[model samples]
Target: MTKHERGALSANAPKSGEADLETRLSRLRAALDGRAPRLDAPFPAVTLIFSVSDGAARAVTAQGSGATVDAAWEVAVTDLHRKMGRRKLRGRFLRLDWVEKAETWTWALLRKRLREVKRNYSRRGIALEKGFTHLFLEQELNGNAMLYGGNQISHCVVNEKNFLIYAQQKYGSGITVDFADDREVHVFDTAGLFCGEDGVLHELYGAGRNAGRRKIDPLDVDTLRGIIGDASDFLAHQVGADGRFIYGYHPCFDRQIPAYNALRHASTTYSMLEAWELTREPGLLAAIERALEYLCRQFIRTAGDDMAFVVDTGDEIKLGANATAILAMSKYASLMGTDRYAGIMENLACGILHMQAEDGSFTHVLTWPDLAVKERFRIVYYEGEAAFALMRLYSLSKDERWIAAVEKAFGHFIEKDYWKHHDHWLSYCTNELTLYRPEMRYFRFGIRNFEGFLDFVLQRITTFPTLLELMMAGRKMLDRLKAMPEGAELLAGVDEAKFEQALHFRASYLLNGHFWPEYAMFCRNPDRILGSFFIRHHAFRVRIDDVEHYLSGLVAYADYIEAVAGSSDGAVRA
Candidate 1:
């Protein structure tokens, strides 16, 4: 199978032509031969990577750098030739991180950065896959994503904000963790990779594209559907005969994440159904039912008097947990055309309503069984999640109390300006609510959530799937307003152009962190980990929630494409 890659631009990105690469290589070859042609620029270094399948059976990659082309060439080529004695070359690869005369920093600072780089490699993201967002080393295949020896360094490519060089040299581990099990990683600089094939050196990686592949456009309907199907398959595969998901993985060493979240389990099941609307795979359906059965049996509290709440493992009820449980049940009811979980949903919804106050904000957590208040707040996300869940229940039951409670809660949201958080669930609720109410106040509130938020989403490097979900919900709101006669007057303040661009960019940007087969094959269990979404900055952490948001967003975006991009049937399935 051909490798799939994404196009990314970096500082001083390498040129975009094979002929140009050959000329650059020729210049280096001549400089090494003492032919020393007119060198008007700092020549790029060449690196050779090889795979070791000998007795002890390991991978060996030799990297080198020096003051000039000849000097660096001698170090890299000499090492490459030396290693070729007994071990065969896996693939002759080149991606030189350090460039000569490409520095202006003091020697003291350079030594410090390299020392820190060594210090970072042995830290938690590699060892434990988490470091509280400060010192995590994001293992990726990009060359310019490191701070080694302080040559050709770019601040934007730094890892978690722990790098001390620029206020905090935030660059993480430079190791490319996704190279083939048989191939070695090429990281810590922007670009340059050519593989020897059929007696001719061919470009395997360049600044314009990632390792030997082209970009996968997430906006295209066909590509989006294919990705959605793959993601659905991945999620389905995670479900076991007992109905529990595989949870997640660290991926650096392929260790499973140690904990589980009931809320995430419910949300994941909900998203699988959402994708099922488009891809009605029987195996996927079976997995969804198993997961739903797991949710009801493992998480739902049956003892609450006509008001059941989802109790997590610790015997605690979270506003978000019950909300997602309600969502999953509600989706299941609508999908199979049965009311199997209607009573359970009503109980869960009532349980959620009990957690709300007269002034409209949820008590974030409560003790299970007795249903006593544990805390007033745990996280801001629970608020939107609570509102969205009520709206979902209202769709199935048409309960006036549900909408009324939501409106009462929105009073708090509007009064306190809760839209500032730009939560995806709030956007979801606003869209669902306006379908019934369609009031100007709700429309105005919904639009503000995304007003200044698009810029942040567009610029964020992490594959934050919720951001796209927020944008998709906001787009539905925008489309609704445009259809209204009064929308033109309100459109003046909103930059529709910028909003669309950000939405499109974010939808595509998310693909960067996906575990396509090309990269996922490097993991310990390729079949188990393939097609899930990962947070690259977090050492490629793949958990249930990550895939949940990813599947939900992609399914929603694909539905959006179907509706506006010319489908005779514009309705999104249950």
Candidate 2:
């Protein structure tokens, strides 16, 4: 008659015992369907990075003078070329024909073309040399210290030389060009430099605290030039025989997809045009086409349950592995063209949707094989992460379906009241999720109160049967039933074995659930490392930031108290 008595008897009822089974099923279903009441309300931070776009496309909406250095520099080059009476000698943009020619042509001919250009530049003196050296040097010297680490320097150098030769052959050596370490040299912004937080120098020159380093490094004009050169060269040409850029990496899923480093090189080749300083390199349009094709193949072959992606098995069960791959695939598909991949992307999105739990948590594959849900689910950070990706997809396609899916799935954070906790785990977990939502739109992500989120989760575990205890209890009961005489036959009628599947799910959820040990973000700082080897401190830090100052532990405690009072545990445990 009581709720406690009702829940207990419900699980014990025979499938053929219509009244008891119906009563149990009805309560369980009602618990699931009951209005998921959200108590507190307030505004919060809106977090999400805008998607990448070409300068020309972004320029339309981009505020400011609407001037790019490449454009200005191009005009300057034309003027200088006319001054030298060699206006027709500029480098032919590297087209697909050139790539094919280089692929098939021996280094001997490529070398010969180089010698002839050198001859012309030498004759033109500083005017021609200045243009050539500046253009080529900048390409060779620029680099991203964060991405390539110490390797950025070497990458820039190789790409620079190649671009120089290509430029000489197309443009008569009438333009001057050269490169040097931007740090050691002085350069000026023709349009006057922006000192604002999101200025060009800040973005390209490495101003602000390098999230890679806690210290802020102001952008140097020279460094910006070098970075632009390095980025351009890396993006434009194959640095070597492997058909890769300077770092020989791809920009997609920096950690998840295999050969990501190489793929990054490839992706940046196309994606970096807006950021890096450079005119349209002769071969860039074709390179963009090729890069997109390669990227598409990478996505199709690796972003699913049976794909060639990183964390494809039990080996690399880190937090964002599968979801990151899926995110990359969606972005790449949208950027390339939707007509070809709308259906496949929809299916992938659907698969992830099916994995959601009643509590709004998701399971990583570590504990459960795949569909096992015996244990109470642990919050997997990826659920929140994948929601960001979904939000981004909505932004790109303006698809109502994608927006709806993101709203529902991401709304889980509020439903579970998971973001109110404070801890490094909550910091990293919630930061990415909240980044994607519209400003102050969601209840959970509404503001900074992560301390509250952590308190709520811990309070719930202490107040009620913890997720692990629930799993153990559920399993124990199932085992007892299995041991009964004719238990197998009886179970067939009630589908006890079918119900037992939740155990595996529960285990998997526990294995993959989110925990905010300091280790989620950085490796070097001893404070950031957790107890898991699969999760490297380095990977965490490289991927996200540490936002602990703005968290609320108080809110999390409140949620815990509520779940304890309302759930089956209230009757069973109390």
Candidate 3:
């Protein structure tokens, strides 16, 4: 029988809320007396409701009722998916069913049922326990916890006994699961005012309709709040005076980076930015200042060169991913209208410029004991990124030398030698290149093709039948940026289509491909990953179980953190 059926029956014939183990057992016997004939008749499907309202509650089905909770669950959950349509999540169960058979209605059986549900969701890349505040510690339950305010968990998946104890310790009462109806289950606390599924907390404290318009999922937001709160707690608990953050616990094994300082700065800065945009919150400016102070101190003793790489220990640089971080610092500097970072910016800019070869191409790494030219294969991808950075700096400083340097470097991208290397899929590079040098007509040609690619992605999203089609659309977009025009003002009097195409292409590729993934992961593990990662690298694959698909998210988050904290963009501050 399905858990829903059990819950329905249980609700009709329930145990005591406050009765001790023995009394509850006695009450169970008494309640079953009238229902004995049904119990002896057949093992009817029972519906279960795991409600969280007032002090650990439960509603079991009538002893021998013939309710099919499984069928009820399938119908209800399927309906939710159909109703939700495009926003439907992969593994989220709109309804639940019970699996374990309790020889008798006991709390232990309920606990076992919860674990089974948790496992089912976990396989779909959902971490049910991670976002649950009660599972973590008692600290989160008191006085306005952020997770409680805007947190969510898909469902419970773990040891039910442990979960109960955790809840009891935090709330001073055990959890109660109630079957509200054939379609819904509710989790309750002491007052029963707040419910895990439908109590008023979400409507009261969560993001409202504006959030839905912004494409923020209510469930997703709640889950993120938990992850973010947990991360914040972890940092507060582990960070030393030196600002080094430690993660010597489950899931990660032993992988750690010296990034807490940068991460905290980035999250705070991003929050402030969001607050200013979302609310007229005036305190964010002060928060940014405070964040900047911490960020500046972290880098005061470190050399400017090391600041660009993800894990630079005095020498060598990891350029491609680090470029984004550098770009962030540059954007922040321009936004803040402050040149306090001028000294650091100058050093990194010079270092990057020095790395460019006479041929105009650049490598992923420029410094090493053995000057292996093989290690310096013309990495067109990062070369284009660095060029974009140079262009941004020129825009900011209006330095003639900077313009001359970019023009020369851009020239090499179009040469017959370079053009042949990219084939037909080089347009992605030019989309970014156009931003730096829009004056040249030849570059405008490349821009046109890139714009075409953007239209392609849009069409695919609309017409394509599968996720593979979407990915192919992305490939088509990236493969067309082979070469660009020589001058800087290529788009000076161009039609809207050209610019619009470029913008759409970037919006799809960068925002969907990079930004979404990072945000999803940050929502899942906010402490280590941070939300800026989501902004920097924002896209997730069709099903989240594909963890390897997280490279872009990881790199993007790293770059975002660097951008927020560092004085300037890395070796190339653009």
Cα RMSD (angstroms) for every candidate in the order listed: 10.2, 27.9, 16.5
Q: Is candidate 2 or candidate 3 better by lDDT?
A: 3
Query: Which should have the higher lDDT, number 1 or number 2?
Result: 1
RMSD from true fold, candidate 1: 10.2
Instruction: Please name the candidate that would achieve the greatest lDDT relative to the true structure.
Output: 1
Alpha carbon deviation, residue 82, candidate 3 (Å): 32
Model 3, range 100-150, lDDT digits (tens) per residue? 221222334434454454211211110112112222211111111211211
Model 3 TM-score (2 dp): 0.41
Q: Give the lDDT ranking, best first.
A: 1, 3, 2
User: TM-score of every model?
Assistant: 0.72, 0.31, 0.41
Per-residue error for 106 in candidate 3, Å, reads: 31
Q: lDDT for every model?
A: 0.64, 0.30, 0.32
Ranking by TM-score: 1, 3, 2
lDDT of 3: 0.32
Please give the range of 10 consecutive residues that has the lowest summed lDDT in model 3: 190-199
**Cα lDDT tens digits for candidate 1, 413-491:** 9999998899999999999999999988899999998998878987775567899999999999988898998776677
- After superposition, which runs of candidate 1 have C-alpha atoms over 4 Å from their true positions? 1-213, 521-527, 566-574
